[model samples]
Target chain A: MTRMLTFLVVAAAAITIAACDTTGEQAMVPGAKYSMNVEDGRFHNIHATGQKLACETCHAGTEYQPDFVTLSKYADDGGASPGIVDRAACLGCHKAGGIATAWYGGRATR
Target chain B: MVKFIRMIDMERCIGCRACVAACYTENYHTSGAPWNAVIEHEIGTYPNTGLAYMPINCMHCEDPPCKKVCDDMGAHAISKNEFGVVLIDYEKCDGCKYCAAVCPYGVPQYNETMMELYPGKGRTPYENVSDTDRHPTHRKKPKVMEKCTFCWHKLEKAVADGKTDRIGRDPEYTPSCDVVCPVNARLFGDIEDPNSAVAKGIGAKKATQIKKEYGTRPQVYYALVGGDF
Candidate 1:
């Protein structure tokens, strides 16, 4: 009975922690604290409301390895994991006259 | 007026890393990143699966993306020589790795530290050579990008010796990787001359450049098992 009660308490705590770690809708902005890890991704929020950004937009068909940022390929689902993001891919949407803010060279242009 | 080109016949390649070892002996590479690598990939289905070895060095593209990216970032570190060999000026590079990030082939490796070839065994005699004695390409430093020069040091020597016509035939003029290939799988020569050995070999084998869609127009060509890819 003691062991069963202990197991139940630990399981309940884990569930509570995971629920608390969920990202809110407000964290989908440009400079938000987003996780690069696909497993813990809030990409759905970024892709919500007519965004419709595909996974291949930033990843796939690339072998570039950047030293600036760490890329994660973690995925819980048994799906095709996204490849590492090349800076060229980032420039596609992040450069001047693009969708996102023109941010590069250690600063953001508003 | 010579345009150098390197060719690899994949069908004849036995996956023997002799070319890779020859590169290390010729160039001082960091611990993790090598100037040359022989990658093995599978072709065909499970029933008809076969492996293919691709020995890759710097393609020395005619319009190198690494140079363009470096110039765009105001680095001005990379330069394509008259011979169409892409080289990085280590002094100008700040190790930002922007070139590394933009390269489709994953060339341009950054050396974090000057690790000895043998760990805890002290520097090898090759590594202990004075910097003055070493060629600029072989003088590797920490926190900078490095890649194959297509053995420009040898090519430069060939030019100085007035043996430009005998590059592919001369041992001192040819790239160490090509010279060391036991199976004669690798070839290096000027592709400008329609009568040159490399030009003839490429035409006869129907060799094609890989990743041509990137539009880098790499000078290196590969003779795959089948026809051009």
Candidate 2:
């Protein structure tokens, strides 16, 4: 009886903590707290926009490593990409002089 | 406000190719491909033919066709910096040859095979050493586009060291190809500075960009050339 009561209390507490985590995801570009790093993306708000999205939906990388980032097919040890994102991955949607500017501003490289 | 450019005086060039050796050492180019080279052009009749040794490299065009094509291919690895230096981002490059195809100067060299700088002799000190602070450009991979960056690392170092004035004047800051010219044929400096050697050479020798008709607007100029770009 004591074990059953403890389990019920723990479950109720876990639910309360989860509910208090956040009211809702916001809509807009990510703020300073967010990071676009590959590991833990700051795409929470983006993800909350009524669709389950994978990185490959936009990144579309190589055959070996399919994402926006082009990882080496040979090894998993090396630091393939240092830290910065490949802005080029967004070119599919935001072409030069289209709704968005090119990767390097004022260049109009495309 | 600085427009960097190089002026090659063909009248003074003897094609020693010392610059090539220097570049090979500086750039870790142990492969079959060369980042800089001298093109030997033969002029006039066979019986009375003459030779011209034209040094060829990335023109660093004002309107680069290479970058445009790379962008179109969606690789977006090529970038022309504010200093007019053209660079290829290796990590983002998908081994696309669009840049190489559209370049009028044929400057973008792709290394398909991996080779050592010295097979029997062993690795270079720079190669063997692990330097986290080394410039990223030095770590370029094979199968990606490569070209003359006008010794961009050196220039960036110069800037970081607050010695921008030392560039083109100091051997440490200047391009290896520019400094290694035995006959002093290759000139590098800001064309915007009328007092600079490159500007004076361009003015005095009537230097012209290669393939101006192509409208590439190449920053590299040739002075006293016998043939067209």
Candidate 3:
């Protein structure tokens, strides 16, 4: 009986630790290898807006320096005319349920 | 011995926000954090109402309140270099935001998260680009207060590249916003150099600085559309 009780306590502690580690991983933004995605997007969006230019206009796969993967999978799909992005493309990352929407609430109409 | 100055012609400004956009792209790291702001104010009652578009940026003052408050905090993070550029050292800053709180112009911005200007180059957003490709004029830290450096990096590059004569003349060296102005409403150059176009333009226009009562003595001069606006 004593041995069984000790085993049960150790198992519970292990499960708790495992749960915490998994939670931490899930909380992290996906595809965020080096930088926080939110902050990166903020700078990118600001620059695009400030220049009166679109992100896809310069950074599309056709551009000399393309980092479409940083934006969305749509660009990765090799769709032509990446120069002009629409609400659908924007919503992929900035979805209503995404971390970005949660932080900014609603998108600016520009 | 040249003092830098900017002249903004309000009469020619169409409120297209091209200058604002150019400023953001050139200084994307601090882009959303506006160094130049466009405030649209309307005057008059009905059909005769007129809209005034005012673009505001850091004065780079003779006696900057932001610097005074930073000095008072004992941090001394903000200071005016010999060229009259107001700069903040992020490494020395404790993110106390004391400078932001006291800035009458509201130029300082507190960056909470790390942002990568050049993405997907094996660089983390939190990593400071100033550590590697140090901006020719100003050094930037990941998390700190930052504002418009007036494209100091480009200016320094031009000087280093032995194009000192083109400091104010080169469009690439010019602040992105100033260069992108469709109507040629913005002028940038050394104020002390009477020959420079910016100085001559402001002199001819009788340009005025905003909020002169604060005594910031801003380098940015504006030719307002109407009197006392």
Candidate 4:
């Protein structure tokens, strides 16, 4: 009984650790991990129009690219999604008093 | 013993982006690597809301964290000159970006690809210059970290010509962004010289460097919105 309890406790701790790592990587997807889409319901839920945006809507643009140095900290690959460079795409809906959260000049604070 | 520094009066900034445009044009930076940026933040709340604009560049600290990290990684690409300007040698940069990870200000920008200024349209006249003809700072390469050099190219020319006295007073010797400020919000000169405009401004305005807790001892000072501490 002692052996079984110890094994179960160790297994639970391991699972918790793994779960935390995954959560840390996924929590700030819109800011850091834009390349990897989150299965969270908020990923495509455009606020005002209630439109479900396709990946291309935000990912298709070469005009502005992500600051690779900043992105690399979050994404191990050290690169943003193809054509999804800077926050230019999200600015359309993420400015002051915009449909989504306020993000300006690499800051998401208000 | 001349330590160059910049003093920005943020109280006078109108967020026109003229300084940003000037830096981009003067440096001829490719897409994604802006040497200067004007960060906007919504301050206060409700009816008391206000927008604060902070024009930031490389802090060019007395003890730069970027240089420390780069040197630790055995890159040794980052160097601080006698004039107190921090610069990166493009050739020596391995693009490992360890410096980027440590920088408190998020100053280093990694250029993955040298994209055209006007994408799909073509390179601008500024971008079309040959590497041989351009200043070393302007000779940008892909897959390397880049940041503002405090317009070291122009400052170097002043030193070469023995006209360091003309630095803050003349456009040829001044940082491009400082030279183009519509409002006289930007001042660049020798901070070590007690009589210099920047030094006097620092005293008169009680100018303070941002992120003081970092202990980097930045050369860039700002007359902040509320008050300089």
* The candidate that achieves the highest lDDT relative to the unseen native structure: 4
lDDT to native, each model: 0.74, 0.70, 0.63, 0.75
Model 2 C-alpha lDDT per residue in residues A1-110, reported as the tens digit of each score: 99999999999999877655543323222322333233354443333332244544443552224542354456582333333334344444434454532322224342
Taking all chains together, the TM-score of candidate 4 against the true structure is 0.68
Error of 2 at A48 (Å): 46
Candidate 4 lDDT at A82 equals 58
Off by over 4 Å in 1: A1-56, A59-110, B226-229
Ranking by TM-score: 1, 4, 2, 3
Residues A19-68 of candidate 1 have per-residue lDDT tens digits of 55443333333212432223444343344222555555566553344331
Q: What is the full ranking by lDDT, best candidate first?
A: 4, 1, 2, 3
- Residue A18 lDDT in candidate 3: 77
List model 2 lDDT by residue over B28-108, tens digit each: 673866789899988788698888889888899887767875675566788888888888888887665656645657688
Q: Interface RMSD (Å), each candidate?
A: 10.9, 11.4, 16.6, 12.3
Stretches of candidate 2 above 4 Å error? A1-110, B120-126, B131-133
Q: For residues B166-187, write the lDDT of model 4, one tens digit per residue.
A: 9999999999999999998999
Clashes of each: 0, 1, 2, 4
Model 2 chain A weakest lDDT span, ten residues long: A23-32
Measured by TM-score, the strongest candidate is: 1
Query: What does candidate 3's lDDT look like per residue over B1-229, in tens digits?
Result: 7566788988888889987777765665542356667878786779878887877777777767567646645677777766677777777676656555445566787776655445446554434445556553345555667877777777666657866456567886777778888998889888877788898899898888876645457888899875545
| TM values, all candidates | 0.72, 0.66, 0.60, 0.68
Candidate 2 vs candidate 3: the TM-score winner is: 2
